[model samples]
Target: MNTIQDISKFSSQEKTFVTIGTFDGVHFGHQKIIEKLVSDAKNANKKSVLLTFFPHPRMVLQKDSNIELINTIEEKKSLLQKTGLDYLIIHPFSKEFSRMTALEFVRDLLVNQLNISKLIIGYDHHFGKNREGNIVQLTEYSHLYDFVVEEIPAQDIDDVSVSSTKIRRALLSGNLKTANNYLGYHFMLNGNVVNGKQLGGKIGYPTANIDVKEDYKLIPKTGVYVVKSNIDGLETFGMMNIGNRPTVDGNHQTIEVHFFDFNQDLYGKNLTIELLYFLRDEQKFDSISALIHQIKKDEKTARDYIKNNL
Candidate 1:
């Protein structure tokens, strides 16, 4: 799939089939709509185009700073690429752009810029200044611009929003199974490997500390989890700790991964770990030996789960 960072930068005169949304997780419900879009576009001999906004519209228009996203920008792009989409256009969301009227958005961006032949959108979708553009306005604009406006049923689009909410709730509650079910894939954490106190090394369980820089990216409930990552083209299995080192009296939360049968230096390397299962919630052990003992048990449990299920 070709990814366009900005819609204005793309020079295209050919007509296209387009859909517009944040498409945050690209979860199962979103996939349903995208599938119809790609299939219909292919049947009609038109390129499929997805126009999305970065910073999320809420962040820019409503100043929603506390919103957490299921996937980062790169992660969202990676997921969308696997959907057989033709063009993924990520446009910057700003206050100025938010002020554009529904008519202007349809005329300037969709018709003039993208040369849109058809627009596939959610049944209740609203866009443009203060979200004044509903299906009613979209239909009118489609007629004026000589493009088709196909609205996915309310039930289908409602599932997309509902699933997004359920996925976040499931992740924050340590329900990995439910979260993955809603997401249609493993929930992942991507970050750079950073230096740590080396306390796990002393306990015969060396770990790589992950430092996720995106403040908007959601982190799952603090606990231990079974995880997998592809490092240097090789698949590696591991257990990750997403909590403070309470046994050592540490206060700040840290994401640490201990890979099985691997001992290579990983400092400064970026890693994407997919959470497979939730083992247990984090707790403070009585002593160093006690903590080590519990970790060994956790490893065994993780290994068994991986062996039987994976």
Candidate 2:
């Protein structure tokens, strides 16, 4: 998909079909909406476009206090691009922009700027200050602006509505199975390998330290997880520990990954850690030997899990 960061660059293309939202996780529900949008746009011989925000509007409007983001800007762009949409419009959300009224947002953005011939939105979507725009308001504006407005109804699986918030909660609580089911894929984090104190090496289990992106990202609660690490395009089963080394007397938390049967140095390289299952909570060990023994057990458990599942 063509990522349009600035509204001024949104040139007049074929008749546009658009949907506007944060699209944080791009979960299964979001995928369903995008699929329908693509289908409708194709039938109408129009370009399918997605309208989303960068840094998330809430981050700007709420000052420094913002909820944890499920996906980064680049991650969102990459995921949306996989949908085969014609355009992905990223609005640089700001306080001034958020002040616009609901009608102003639709009139100026959708109708005037994008020249939207058809608009699609989630069933319970809201926009503008105080989130005043509803399906009723959207329909009313469509009548006045001479455009089509469509709302995709809520999607449910096993009676549970799929949502980004729900998936985030599940992931934070270390329910990887449920979170993956909701996300339609394993939740993943990609980061550059960085040098760290050689504590793991001292203990005879070397690890690669991954530095996660700070903005638009939140680490799950400190724990151990069974993960698939993609290094140089090869996937390896691994066990990851994310937490402060409480037992080892370390002060800062870390994301350290040890790939099973991998011996090459990955320092300075990028690694994508795909979380597959949660093994256990982070805990303080009684001694270094105890920790080493537990790590061995975790490795065996991770290997078995991957062999049976992956």
Instruction: Return the lDDT, model 2, position 260.
Output: 87
Model 1: how far is 166 from its true place, Å? 2.1
Total clashing pairs for each candidate: 0, 0
Which candidate leads in TM-score? 2
Question: Residue-wise lDDT of candidate 2 within 36-67, one digit each (tens)?
Answer: 99999999889999988887876877766757
**Candidate 1: where are CA atoms >4 Å away?**
154-162
Instruction: State the lDDT of candidate 1 residue by residue for 209-291, as single tens digits.
Output: 99999988999999999999999999999999999888896789899999999999999999999999999999898899999
Q: Residue 44 CA error for candidate 1 (Å)? A: 1.1
Each model's lDDT comes to 0.90, 0.87
- List the RMSD of every prediction in angstroms: 2.1, 1.2
Error of 1 at 290 (Å): 1.7
What TM-score would each prediction reach against the true structure? 0.94, 0.97
